[model samples]
Target chain A: MESHIELSFEDIRGKQHATLIHFIGDLDATNIELVLEKVFNLINEGTVNIIADFKQLRYVNSTGLGILLHFSKTAREKGGCFKIANINENVYEIIEIIGATTLLEIYDDVDEATAALT
Target chain B: MTTQRMEIDIQEVPESEGVVILHFSGDLTSECVRRINECFSAVGKKGKTYAIANMAEVTLISSAVLGEFMGCRKRLIEEHGDLVFCGLDLEMRTKLHLMGATKIFRIYTDIRTALNSYKWEIERQPEKFHVSFPPYLKIVPPLRQLVSRIARQKGYGNRDSFRIETIVDEICNNAVEHGRPKADDLIDLTVIIDPDKIEIDVRNMSDPDKVASLTAMLLPEKTDTDKPKPDVKRGRGLSLIKMLSDGMSVECTDRGTSVRVKKVREE
Candidate 1:
């Protein structure tokens, strides 16, 4: 019984320091540090404006939500932004219940999140 | 000689909306008033107005704790909630009656009828599932999946099923991370699927300090501060479980901690 999370990154074609990361598999306490390390590494390399694609994300718990909020705050402090798009209904419900919808930037689609990135 | 202290166990009664059961064992006297008050007040703090004090195991009782219960019952009534008693042996019953406390509180022979008084329909033949494994992070995902699948088959909608999965994942993950179970320690997960809701109980070996911290986090000391601030990177799992579940309670003893959560199926 091994839980896995895969992170794949794509650079927005014309954006200078923005990247889109697609989350795959379950994000939880077991694998949160891995996601944290990867996101921190990207931020350290000057890719602060990031968009997370949750279309492929099957599951996420509070630990996962914590990191997402951490990323958003970290990116904003560096004059960048962490925006989420294509969030499935289930994931959105958890985020909403925890009252994180206002804390993190959310868009209905990836293009909208990307278009709003400054 | 060391005096035996009382053990206070708090549980949310099944299907009783906003009601809880406070089970007291051993002698409950003035020495145990503070512990008793915290447990009683904690129930009121959870927005629960009604409680059933199961006194079957109590061998001794004192006026101080009885006063504390009277105070709690008064507060519950003020808030449109109440405190009742069940499973009282004849001796305990006579104690309450002699003190005139019986007039102030509703008394029941057992917990089942007490819950019925609240109009809580007890489920019949609820589907139950149990699993136990070493406290390992890897085991959580698959277990959550299996539980979520069970919820779906039991008629929970996708949203409710996801809530069930999140509750299981968050609690199990918290158990492993905070519990820090030894290699041989096992985490037990039990889920009951009723026609109208799903109930889950997860137990893990934990020290008293860990249990205290988890309890504080699960049920915040006050309702005003119930929601965890969005910025903190840690200590949000228990809060999330609290928010998403219909009813939740924790019982901690020296040996281990058990967290029970309930989620009602959305119509």
Candidate 2:
């Protein structure tokens, strides 16, 4: 099934941009490629600071993580930062155990991650 | 396949009406928190002081689900109910204990004993078997559903089934997305189900060096005064698998990398 993934962008402060990508429904192989494409597009446009708001994200598999890693690398190379905010603790732990916390910043709230970008 | 409605029933105990019994079933994930909250809210309406979750029929609960449990407990206490738990299988209990919730929730072997201190009747053990799958990127949800059904037939509940499904999805997807050189490259998955526990073993013929690098990449050495740079997406999958399963073992031999996940059945 196709996932209803939503990506919202907001300019937090200065060059610090917060793109809130809400992953709704299943983020499986069916639509992960599209999601990755969207993420790359945002990074290519220099949308540096990103906060993936996973409040609405129901599920995410390994392919989803691969996409996130790809974008995180791109963001870092461009001197930008990528973070995830407002994630459910379960989702946060999933991200944490995968050592995503080591590679990407995780915030309890969007404000905190946005503040870091500033 | 029928999409089941989430349901929770809370009843006041006769001896200690302060203790509420929460019976829940179906998939308990982040999305189901609102429903769980509603159940807690209903229990709060009764004005009881303490509560216990009757997890007998509950098959699986994710870390997110556990968070919701804690969150609900906090909410209940704020309204005068102390939260506890009953009917957790060894797998669920172990996960909760590992997360330090065993200290948080008062766990019992069964609902009747938890409710009235009556002799708890433990059910007979279920048959167990192991099955393996080849790693590939496109995960077959139906196959996962079938496995879950098999588990349920063996007396595992929906919650446990969901846990198995989630782990399988994570491991198989990793093999497909990162482990294999091509889409057709096989990722082997094996599930061993016995009365006591279910053990999942997944193997893929990927580059061992790449696997080692992936492992190293997961635990980056900390430098002075600064946090390590986030890799963005590549790292969370394995970590999530580790967090969800009771125990995990990762081994990379000359041929491939193997990940084994075990979930014990509750009595």
Candidate 3:
């Protein structure tokens, strides 16, 4: 699938603690690495908390879900939090069925997720 | 310019009941998946949960499309709906069946039948021999005995029987761990003893991510990978399976995940 992943704040302020990522297009074996690379870069850049905006995410395969698990775990290990927001009904149910929702701190939208992170 | 390898047309008739039919013509090689996904995404955005993909016009299909189907199925099922395929030619149907998609989808002979049959779910038809196992105690011995009995019934010699049993061992071992099934879940073991080959499938309900990792792990590296060290914790079962079976593959479906291994009997 043609997965388009965009990470906001290519250039970030040194004091900025939280980041927002807008996930578009399909998330599968093909596109997950590109998406994860950006997520990892943000984490490595010392973004304490990240909000993965899934407002436009159309498809998420198992690999994508696994990437999310890795994202959450890495953020937690670093004393920060990784959460999700604005996911459609399908993505929400997929995560819920897989029992990964418990591991993720999810919110309704990016604004709510960011407000709580701050 | 020569014709494109694929053409995708979305048939979104007003009364299709949340179903969108993607009609594909031309070759179904890997390059076509991106086009399929783009049209599929459009359907998803419209809140359509069911799809009837008509591939009759397509001359051929590939295993890559099977993986693509699994992705689309997950998205649809996540919305409490399903995806069905129809009008696939015989070669494609045989390929789909070999890939064990019959267990995942309710494929029909035509679009009308496919659309009408979506009222309920459909699973694979019964095979000649089948067994169900609980992932308790040692799983190999019982499965070995079962395979041996079938092999003997089919007049398989010791060498052939042993080979089949070995494949069973490798696939079942991986299924037990990676399947991560719940208490109520049972590992379904099925044997399809065709005239010339015996196909074994092990099905279990597990996390999609787990299945994805297993598929990725077992996928033969484009460049050869070095053997894992003794202390290494992974890739052992998949490697053993690839060594033993003539063919083996895993698929994660809306129902669950299955690992299928086939061994052809020598004349």
| Candidate that would win on DockQ | 1
TM-score for chain B of each model, two decimals: 0.51, 0.44, 0.48
**Model 1's TM-score against the true structure:** 0.65
Candidate 1, clashing residue pairs? B49-B82
Candidate 2 local lDDT, B36-74, one digit each (tens): 877777777777656778887776677787888898888
User: In model 1, how large is the Cα lDDT of residue B243?
Assistant: 80
Tens-digit lDDT track of model 3 for B96-126: 8898998998788998767645532322222
lDDT of 1: 0.84
* Best-fitting candidate, scored by TM-score: 1
Q: Model 1 misses residue B233 by how many Å?
A: 1.7
What TM-score, to 2 decimals, does candidate 3 have?
0.35
Interface RMSD of each: 1.5, 4.0, 15.5
TM-score of chain A of each: 0.97, 0.82, 0.86
What is the lDDT for B91 in model 3? 85
- Candidate 2 has a DockQ of 0.25
In model 1, what lDDT does residue A23 have?
95
Show where candidate 1 strays beyond 4 Å.
B1-124, B218-221, B224-228
Task: Work out the TM-score per prediction.
Answer: 0.65, 0.47, 0.35
Tell me the tens digit of each residue's lDDT in model 2 across A1-118: 2445666555565544456665565566657777778877877776776777777776566557667666777777877777777776545545555556676677777777667775
The better-scoring model by TM-score among 1 and 3 is 1
Question: What's the iRMSD of model 1?
Answer: 1.5
